[model samples]
Target: MLLKTFGWSFAVTAAGLALAGVLWGWKGLAIVGILSILEISLSFDNAVINAGVLRKMNAFWQKIFLTVGILIAVFGMRLVFPVIIVAITAKMGPLEAVDLAINNKDKYEHLVTAAHPAIAAFGGMFLLMIFLDFIFEERDIKWLGWLERPLAKLGKLETLSIVVALLVLLVTAMTFATDVAHGGGDKTATVLLAGVAGLLTYLIVGGISGYFEDKLEEEEEEVEEAEEAERAEKAASGAQKGSQGATVVGLAGKAAFFLFLYLEVIDASFSFDGVIGAFAITNDIFEMALGLGIGAMYIRSLTVYLVRKGTLDDYVYLEHGAHYAIGALAAILLITIKYEIHEVITGLIGIVLIGASYWSSVVRNRREEAAGGEDAESKAEVTSGV
Candidate 1:
């Protein structure tokens, strides 16, 4: 199962190593290895969230996520996005941007790094909304009841998350926008605008997806009612038929289209910091793309694996951990705009939060098993007594 699930990842990793060797010999191979590790370490939470969303989609959409989405992640975001940023910001043409990256590596890195304020605000705001919306919505299962329950109550007030997000963006602009190191001069306005753009992107994408999902739900409910009504007749006639009529399709058609777009945007927001952080390790655009692309293959495989194996169902709080990691990353991105925090630190925080949540889930499972055992023993004793 593992081999079948992750064959593509293995192929990609091999290709990455070969590409690195062909391009820059042994040193390039080593750099690609390091970048791949860095990318994987930073994005485990992304895999978890992707799993949660991907499972809701059908097999066809899931395949597109692995195939087409991987292309976008590797070539589009990792390679082209930075060049476009530099071209726009430096007021240079695409060819000049490419030339700058090749001829003046430091200048290329500097240009990309200089745009961090806007990137951080935008990605941070989008991710923050994702985290806030997840935690605020009421759920039968609560991972961090102490914090989540109260927040869920507050979530009863519609737009609470949007309001909070706007306030945070305002404070971020006022506080860090003036910092000479981060948001120099008029950059604060740029950051604020980017943040608003992020918010709007989330609202528009999420709103469209939500509408289709609701329609799917209503269709499923209607199908179930019809099925129940006909069950008696079918049973009396000694006929059995498989499920039919609208069948609660898993994010089919237009629903899948919009959700796919949502997934891509979310994936982009997750990768924004990773792209910026990669510059800290190496300034080579091709190297960054090769390494991160290899890691991205594995992450995509992991998402599909989790969905197929129903890992989220077994480890109930795993989703909670991923969202919390996202929340932490969002805050870190915003903080990074003002202060230069190490990528290692950012990665570690996510690992720690996810690790703690996993441990808690294990403990809870053990306790439930023990309680079930005790109850069974008591019931047996009473039965023997009778």
Candidate 2:
């Protein structure tokens, strides 16, 4: 299973490294290797979150995610998207931006870095909404019950997540985003506008996905109801045969389509920091694309692996850990607007949270097993005595 899942990722890694070596010698190969590892380390939580959404999709959409989605991630987000951002921010045409990226590496990096405030605000707000929605919604499993319980109760209030996300964006814009100590400019308006745009994108995409999901659920319920009625009629007519299976609709059509859009937007939001941070390592666009692209392939593969293996179902707290990690990343992105935080710190926070949650899940499973054993033993003893 592991080989089947990661075979393509390994192949891509080898090809990418070979290309990097050919292009810029050993140094290029090493940078690409580092960038690949960096993207994977930073995006493990993203994979977990992606798996949670991808599992709801059917086989066709899953295939599309691996194929079409990888192209969008590798080329669109890693390569073209950065150029588009540079073009828009620098008030230049796309060709000019491409020329700048290719010919004037330092200036290109500077322009991209200069656009960091808006990028951070937009990505940060989008991620903050994701984290807020996850924590606020009531779930059967609660990893951080102490905090999540109260938040889930409050989640019953309509638009509470949006209200809290907007408040955070406002405070961040007024405070850290506008701090001149980090860079010499008041970016209040820029941050606010970008943040609102991010927030709105989440709402629109998530709202449409939710609408389709509700429709899917209603259809499933109707099918089950019809099946139940059929079973009742069969039993009442002195029939002893089993009822036929009900054909349930999967998340496909418009539902899967919008959900795919939501996933891509989420992936884009997650990539903002990685794309910007790559400039710190190398100014070469091709190298960045190659390295990040390889890492993205692995992430997509891992998402599929998790869904197929039911890893999330086994480790209940894993999703919680991922969201908490996302919450931390969102806060870090907002904080980084005014302060420099190492990528190592960002990666470590995710690893630690996920690690803790996994351990907790193991402990919970053990306790349940022990309780089951005790109950079984007690019943045996009672039966023997009787």
Candidate 3:
């Protein structure tokens, strides 16, 4: 399973490193290697969150995610997207942006950094909404029962998540975003506009996805009802009972398409920091793309691996951990608009939260097993006494 899942990632890693070495010798290879590692570490929680969404998709959509989705993530987000940002911000053509990226690395990096307030506001708010929605929703399993239970109860209030998100964005725009020390200009209006854009994007995409999901659930419930009726009829006739076939309802058509869009947008939001942060390591745009592309391939593979292995099901708190990490990343992105925060700190927060969740899951599983064993032993003793 490991090879089946990660074979392409390994291949990409080898090719990326080989290309880097051929272009810039040992130093290039080393930088590319470090960038790849950094991207992977920073986006591990992204893989977890992606898996949670991907598992709901069917085989065809999953294939599209691995193939076409990787292209968008690699070229679109890693390469083209930054150029577009620079082009728009610098008031230049796309070709000019490309030239600046290749010939004048320092200028390109500076332009990108200068645009950080708008970028951070958009991406940060989008991610913040994701975290808020997840926390607000009621679920049968709560990892942090004390906190989550109360939040879920409060979730009954309509638009609570959006209200809180708007408040945060407003405060940040008025305070942190207005500081000129970070980027030499007041970006209050820029932050407000971009943040609202991000918020609206989330609402539109999430609303569409939710509608399709509801339709899918209704279809599945009807199918189950029909199956139950068939069983009842068979029992009435005293026919020989046979095993019923399993029913699988996979998202398709418009539902699958919008879900795909949602997943890509989520990837974009996650990549915002990684893309900006890579400039610190190397101002070479192509080198950053190659290294980050390789890392993205591995993340896609890891997402599929988790889905295929049912890892999220086994470690029930894993999704909660990922969302919590996302919340932390969102906050970090907003904070970095005023003050720089190291990528290591961002990565470690995710690792620690996910590690704690995994450990807690293990403990929960062991307790459940012990209780089951005790109950079985008691049953056996009672039967013997009878």
Candidate 4:
């Protein structure tokens, strides 16, 4: 199972090391290893959250997520996205930006780092909305009842997440407004616009998935009714066939398309910190890509493993912890716009929250099992006239 699941991860890591060696020798390969560790450390929460989303998708889309999705994460976000930001922000041609990255590495890093405000605003807002939506939506299990219960009650207010996000953007923009006049070129306005773009992207992507999910539900219901009436003896098998068939045939194409896009955007948001933080470690663009690319490939494989093995179902509060970590990360990203924060601190915060939540889940499970065992024992005693 390990080989089958993580074979690609191993292959990619080997390839990354080989390519790094070829490009810049053993020293370059070592840099890639360090960068890979950094990316993995920072993105544990991302892998968990991705597993949650991937669990909801059908098999076909899950395959795309592993195959095509890895390509986008490794290439688009890790390599090309930063270059595009530099090109747009510094008003340099793509080739010129590439040249700068190669020769004038410091200037390239400066240009990319300078664009952090916009990048943070966009990614932070998107992730903040995700966290807000998760907390607000009603759930049978409440990880933190004191906090989550109140949030769920507040969720009754329509568009509450959007409203809260807008208020946050407003305050953040105003806080940074002074810097714009100090030669930051309207940093506040750029942040506001980017935040709005993030919000809109979430809404559009979510709306598309929801529409298809509803359609799939309706089709499943019809299939169930037809199966019950036509073949009562074979109802179970027939219903299974109908559901799988609907997913494979009717629901696979357009639904998977939007879901694939949604997953990609979500992955991109998670990569924002990793990409920016990489500059602090190395100014070599190819080194950053190879190292972070290997880390990203492993994350994709981890996502697939979580989905296939039903890890999310096994660990009930894992998703909650991941979202809370995301919320913290989002806040940090926005704060970084005004104050520089170390990536180590950012990564540790996520690790701590997720660890705590996992511990809580274990405690909850054991307590419930103990209670169940006592109940069973009591019933046995009464039935035996003890």
Candidate 5:
């Protein structure tokens, strides 16, 4: 599997270069390779987390995640989200804004940098959730029985990430609430607005859309149960096949559509900070796209590798690790929202947390094994009456 992945990685990297060559000859290819590596390195945790989610989906949805899902990451999030960010924050026309970004790279970069703090705040809160969840949750072992009910009930505090974001937001709101007074003007206000938009998007679509989707899913399941009960006798015959076919088809379509839908949103969430971070390295859209696009391929491959290797199932704590990474990244992104921290720092923090989780998981596995061995020995002695 490793060899296969390496082969594909090479194929993708080479293909990306070739595509770059077509676009702008040797310079583009050089930029493409460098950016791809940068993106892949920066997004390691994302790939691990995506694998965990992608594995939960059916094969069809997994394919959708790879194919269409890549498009969303590469083009939708990387290229377009920046423009959307500019559009919301800037006074210029949309095309004119992009043109400004292209022409006046430094000025547009200032806009991207200005937008980073709120982005960091959101990602930081998210990453903090994942981290706390990792430490407290009974994912691999149930060592902390006392904390379980409370953490489970209250859904964990995630105090650090949230507190930081609120502070940042408060400062931002007060400092930049009215554009006329503050030199920063409406730019800060626009960022806060964008943060609300992100929260609302997550709330409305993830919260509301998810609610209706769940309702429809339940109803569909009920109908299927009823159908199964009615068709049980005739299930062996061709007559029932004609009747049951519609039910099966409907369920399959619904599942596929939702699987695709969720992946898209998840990809968007994962890409949010990374896209913002890309501008930090270079504002040239070509480099940003190629680098981020290459990074997107790695994310795809990681998802596939996880699905193929059943790594999530094997590691047990990996999903927890990824979520922790996401929580941290979310927090870091939120920081970018108000402050001017480097993207590399944010990415590194996420990577370190994930690495720590994996290390912890290893130590945890050893301890559990030792405990089990001791228990088995005690049981053996008891059986022997010794």
Candidate 6:
């Protein structure tokens, strides 16, 4: 199993570097390797949360996720999306932005820098939406029962996120229009226009997709019922779930793929902070790419490890721990959209949240065990009638 896991990872890493080599050869490989590791470390919580979601899925979807999701991550989000950001915000033509991103490393780096606030805003709001969605929606078990009732009434964090996003964009426009201007109307107009354009993309495209996503609830319910019935029949038949554990194998694959998607999304979110912060460290696109790519590898491997070891199941609330981390990360992203918090600070905050959640889960588990022991002893005493 270990060999199989490591082998696939090695293949993926080699492929990524070989692609990198098409541009900068051995140097590119060295750089991407370093970056991947950094991303991996900062993304520990992301992996945990992913394990939780992936565990719920079937194996076939998991394979499709790894194969299809990588394309989405590498091309859709990383390559195309950044260029799209540049085209609208930088006021460059879309194709021109893509060409520049390809050929002119320094210019492309500048676009990413200029694009940070918008990226941060998008990620922050999106993450806030995630946390809110988790809170209002029913959970399998209520860890935050105390807070759930209050948080539940807030009604769909996704909707609220869109509102917050619009507010941010408006505020940003005013900042550029009135505060940062050298009194040039056209430049301010461009900023204002770009802000509107970005806002429209979020609202019309991103927002609609998010809002309508809830409509799929019926389809999800039907799928869950069928799955539950199958599980019930299996348990009653007294078949041992051993090496032929197709169910488990299926689950593992699901969990791995979800982790893969979650990792990509987390990396995408973190990239706002990371890629923006990278400029402060080095303007050289090659160095930044190298550092970030290497970091990504580590995050991916960590995600796989969490799944392979059944960390989510073994640790119980580890998934909760990670989402809480994500919540904090989202908040940090929101703050950084305007204030520019340091990467170390953002990462440290996430570490603390996950650490605290793990501690809480341990306490909860111990308490439950103690209660169970007491109950068993009470039953024994009652049967003895002494």
Give each model's clash number.
Answer: 0, 0, 0, 0, 34, 18
lDDT of 6 by residue, 1-386 (tens): 66554565577677777877787677766666655655565666766765655544455554544556545644555456667877887788988986887688678777776665556556765565556556666566656667866666565454664465457555655554343312223233444454454345434543443433333344345446655776977542335334335554544543444445444565576566666666655555555654565454445455556677777665666666677777787767655534557777777777887787778778878999999999999999999996
User: Each prediction's Cα lDDT score?
Assistant: 0.88, 0.89, 0.90, 0.87, 0.64, 0.60
Clashing pairs in 4: none
Clashes of 2: 0
| RMSD of candidate 6 to true structure, Å | 7.2
State the lDDT of candidate 5 residue by residue for 302-384, as single tens digits.
Answer: 77887898766656665655665676666555544435566677677767867776776677779889999999999999999
Q: TM-scores of the models, in the given order?
A: 0.94, 0.94, 0.94, 0.93, 0.75, 0.67
Clashing pairs in 1: none
Q: At residue 201, what lDDT does model 3 achieve?
A: 94
Which stretch of 10 consecutive residues in model 4 shows the poorest summed lDDT?
177-186
lDDT of 4 at 164: 97
Q: lDDT of candidate 5 vs native?
A: 0.64
The 10-residue segment with the lowest total lDDT in model 5: 176-185
lDDT of 2: 0.89
lDDT by residue for model 3 (26-57), tens: 99999899989988999999999999999988
Give Cα distance to truth, residue 74, candidate 6, Å: 3.3
TM-score of 5: 0.75
Model 2 scores worst on lDDT over the 10 consecutive residues at 238-247
Residue lDDT tens for model 2, 285-325: 99999999999999999999999999999999999999999
For residue 126, model 3's alpha carbon misses the true position, in angstroms, by 0.7
Per-residue error for 326 in candidate 1, Å, reads: 0.6
Error of 4 at 55 (Å): 1.2
